[model samples]
Target: MSDIEMIRAARARIAGNLRRTPLLSAPALDAIAGRRVLLKAECLQVTGSFKARGGWSAVSAIAPEVRARGVIAFSSGNHAQGVAHAAREHGVPAVILMPQDAPKAKIDGTRALGAEVVLFDRERDDRDAMGAALAEERGLTLIKPFDDALVVAGQGTLGLELAEQANEHGVTSAEVLVCCGGGGLSSGVALALEAEAPGLRVRTCEPEGFDDVARSLAAGEIRRNDRLSGSICDAIVTPQPGNLTFPILRRLCGPGLAVSEDEVLRAMALAFRHLRVVIEPGGAVSLAAALFRPEALTGETAIAVATGGNVDAALYARALSTLE
Candidate 1:
């Protein structure tokens, strides 16, 4: 199917199955910008993140027999929850592979969604390798968290909604800022935004560690940096950019910007106190870019994708305390 067609099908597939979340506007958020800022609060989405949009869309698109064998997923955080939550709805068994260092909350939450969880030592052994081995051994269909076309299209549905919602809410066009890891969400968001609201500029926000896109865009070549990319904002901590996703984003996105961990935490706090949104470090990243790098979006009304809200309980407490 064509890319637009895939997004259309995903929208239909997920309709009534997911929340028709708001394209929320706030005078407070507007105050941040001389113009205005609209927050697509995907943080409030199912499993507390936008990953659900792609996860449900991709898994459901699979053949019945394929889904019957259940699914295997590799993630450090939010996508794991997305996969597990979607698998639960289909009565499919799921095996999730995660870095042993992944937050305890995500590991537990994945299991809470009724998916079996396994841990790999990301420091010594490769998580992807472990996941591939497990998938082959268990007869599970590996659900690539970002690389899959179905997942990308599924993620694109958000852009479609943003476009439709913007027209309805008096936001005809705006700068779209999305957090990035492997670029699944950013790629889909950019494609959907352009198709839905042509001429939209999409900006990708990344942490310093996995900031490959920013480097590559600057150098005009792929560069890998597996170093620690800020804190446990598991949403955008991809070790490297995806081969399929990078080209699309390079063509679509205006430019990628990186934010510090402090900026991310502070942005997370702002969303909690002002926007009444609870986002993990990764999910709040796009907003972090906005808060710290407004020059990148100078002279435009902006829409930031508040991607996920799956902060560990302890981290949530710490954020709340910092805000207070």
Candidate 2:
């Protein structure tokens, strides 16, 4: 549903609202990965994640009269803060349903952004049903985290930037690794690259046990994760790939990659050391794959998108301690 045209329109609509995060590279990272590696430091993006792009794209596209009624969304954390910030900017009320065990930093961040935060059990509660009911009751528009076309289109804007940046660096062909949850960012990036930089392919990256996207891509159909709440990569632990995003991923992305929790922590530590960018566990998976799973990659270069930086202080300290 999200094509290059819609993605370009999203970029235009969200112009001046979102930051075009930097594409960074360090010789240290390149040496570790055994290839030229570019890190799209989206962790430095507004709201501390790339989700802001999609949130603004979706919220801004709503009819002005309807947008005034407000909007609702369900996220583990990153998307919650994104939608919350966007709604606050538009001067509309926002209600976000977040998993009870999401990082405390994310919960507080969402509330600080002027959105009412509602907690739900990730395993025992159905967020979809609850979000729908709340939307109907409050006359709010439902802004789906990934399944919406506008959200995908909005996220695709990141790909457009990446494509141009890669070209500027003389990277004509490389594997663009994306930290994928329900595949919103990956699918959107895949779609954008397919048109603007066909030589740059997207590869979905996930934590080992919560690799539904990887397994689904291997099977050529959707596959559900057996458990959703155990991974420390909470920002990206979704039960399944989104219906709208999976097909795009299957068609445009390469084989999905899974990295261990230990690998992710190490990647976070290395990112902080070499790139000076703090990355949450979920956001570090792509870098983990790029650094540790080099056997699966092709070409002489790789691009990894560091998706978020909203980690709890304790967790971040623990990740940093790994280097000692």
Report the number of the highest-lDDT candidate.
2
Model 1: per-residue lDDT, tens digit, 279-322? 88888888878766877786567888888888888887776676
Candidate 2 wrongly placed segments (more than 4 Å): none
| Model 2 weakest 10-residue run by lDDT | 122-131
TM per candidate? 0.95, 0.99
Candidate 1, TM-score vs. the true structure? Answer: 0.95
State the lDDT of candidate 2 residue by residue for 1-324, as single tens digits. 889999999999889988989999999989999999999999999999999999999999999899999999999899999999999999999999999999999999999999999899987898889988999999999998999999999999999999999999999999999999999999989999999999999999999989999999999999999998999999899889999999999898889999999999999999999989999999999999999999999999999999999999999999999999
lDDT of all predictions = 0.81, 0.94
Give model 2's TM-score versus the native structure. Answer: 0.99
